[model samples]
Target: MSPKYTLSLWICCCTLFISCSANQPSEERSDYPEADSLIQAALSEDLFTGAVLLIAESGEIVHHKAYGYATLYDESLRVVPSPDSTTTRHLFDLASLTKVFATTYAFMALHTDGKINPDAPVSQYLPDFNTPQHRTITVRQLLNHTSGLMPWYPLYYRAAGSDDLIKEILSLPLSGVPGEARRYSDLGFIVLAEIAESITGMSFDEYLYDRVYSRIGLEKTVYNPLDKGMEDLVSTSHGNPFERKMVYEPDFGYRIDVDPDSWRNWRTYTLRGEVSDGNAWHAAGGMAGHAGLFSTAEDLLLLLQAVINPVSGSNDPIFEEETIRMFTEPDEFGNGLGWAMEPSALHAETLPQGAIGHTGFTGTNFVADPNPDGGRIYILLTNRQHVGVDGAGLYPDLRELREKMAKLVFGEQLR
Candidate 1:
């Protein structure tokens, strides 16, 4: 062959090989058309400033996507300075992921060691927790949020200190009979934290660090980054949606980098390196059994993996196989231990059986279905509170997005 012709043929062969390799499906690619569309839709609506959404089935992460910026320049615009790379780790507020990792994990550790009993009354550990109607409240009731306690109370403003806070929380009257109905209550979990501390002879935070977080190999998951040698990497939050514009004058909260110190005061408090929930933070951002956990998407996925397949890890199982089953399954009120269970197809024509997970108020959610042939797990972490705390409507959008993504990956609708 002529030298020019030989070279041309060699180049064409290399190009063909590259094209074939690019088109070849690696293990990572699983069908997820809905996931891609949902993420793009969330970005378009500004419903989430940034998010890390992942789906795993049969012990593999089938889909992973990162969208938007860690911080926003405007309500609809992303920050100019992106991470070191597109895949760089972004610190998410974690909102209520704290309940699963901090609260539920603490309960499991104590239960596994025989340090605490699920059926024991709260007054057994917290003597001051006694009430005529609430005397029947048990550890299990608290964990399942069926203790008939009020959903939430602003004990932070009413109480002077930690002791006062506990007293005030216990003093509140019950809304209904214990276990009569399912009422999601943060107060129940707050008392549960106290019970864990009283029985274990260690603070909830210390107990978790010693038994759960460290053992689980979660390097970045913590109650408060300020106390964990993580002064940096904490994101600042706007006090209200309009603080950036009206309250702070022209700065509009978004125009300039937030000055953490200026807004650290009690009023217009900007949450940075501190717990956002006032009641939970007042408890020192420890394992509150209700709120106060901060983590990244990767760290949370590790915890979920343990929950879904406990046999794969060397660390002790957080809950026994039976206990895990009980915790993840629906109870009398369609909720489980720290999780909300979806109804079976027979019970609710639109619902799916064995679909269990929890959503955090701070814009975090983890859902998992563990049927051997049809299991799926998803984690969506966002700082929806970045704008402020009032617009809870974003949760519905999140739910819809998750449902759509799940359908795309699992080929079955969640509801």
Candidate 2:
């Protein structure tokens, strides 16, 4: 492989491909025709430059395919002279999916070992949430997105380091009353990580790997894949332009209360192997509970097997059925501890009722149809940011594609 370069993200407009068929023929056929067609349509629409899809039924891989280029365009959008074809092995930023496989799984592991209690106050684990405003919040509520925490904030702008970031997050006022509403708060998950760290006395990632991942057969599933000698990852986004816009442009819709000028540091380069989330990269230093995980569909399936089928392949099940169900069964709030219960955007209409799943920014998804007899695990990993955002300064939305995938995987099950 030729040496890769990390060039300025906003440098140039890449050679615009009219469609994903620019390098490959759209007429190509695969065993999984519906999935192939869906991805091809998405690629033509510039949903992403590359993607990998894997479907496993009862822990058995049924259909696994890769599409498009791993590094189709450079930071400036100029087409790469020799872009690498995406493969199942290439890691894609799992984004918010990290909340499930890494952080949520961390919670499940702790619960299984009797080291943690979902009903317990988070303040008991991390003093950061001990304030009266956050005192009533429970660990389960954080997992359920009912902690009343705001959906997001750019804490990196205000904090000096990870510790300060945690403090700042816990210090923030709530968006609603705790346990009374469901607000998907990344800060809540960040606090969840703080709780995990305080209990384990290890870095969040280290503890997760030690307690759960290491026990299972997840090799490529990891935090900071770049430092682990994983350089050939699917590219994601042209720098943090979208995040910057969120701060600099009030109407961008993120609407953080802080001044945009507060944070001087910004990444101006295209990302590869590096995390795509501003919080995970800038504030949490490449690893956090809410985001910043990298993995391939192949490796993630191993995790699915352990969580769903109780078949760890080469190891013991990561969590018992009871523990897994506690985290997978969503309450009235439509959240299962760390997982999102079925009927969510990804699992809606097609997946079995009460199944568990999660979606990621940067175009990734993990869903499992938790049928008692047999289940299918659906994973779609894409580099939605590789081609850069459209005129609206937004990455292409893959929710429609995600929904289609679930429908494709569960044809007659659609509601």
For each candidate, what TM-score against the reference? 0.77, 0.90
Best by lDDT: 2
Could you give candidate 1's per-residue lDDT for residues 1-415 as a string of tens digits? 7543453343334322322343222332425656656665665554554566777777677766554445543333223243211122545666556777778878877777788878888888887757676678888898887788877665654555666656877677777788787777888887777777888898787898888777778877877677767733434354433323332343432222234334433435445556656667654433466777777666777777667777675555755777677677777776778766653311122334677667776667776776645567777776556543334222223556655554555456443
Candidate 1 worst ten-residue window by lDDT: 343-352
lDDT of the candidates, in the order given = 0.62, 0.79
- Count backbone overlaps in model 2: 3
Off by over 4 Å in 1: 1-33, 73-88, 231-237, 240-270, 283-287, 313-316, 343-352, 372-374, 388-397, 412-415
Question: On a 0 to 1 TM-score scale, where does candidate 2 land against the true structure?
Answer: 0.90
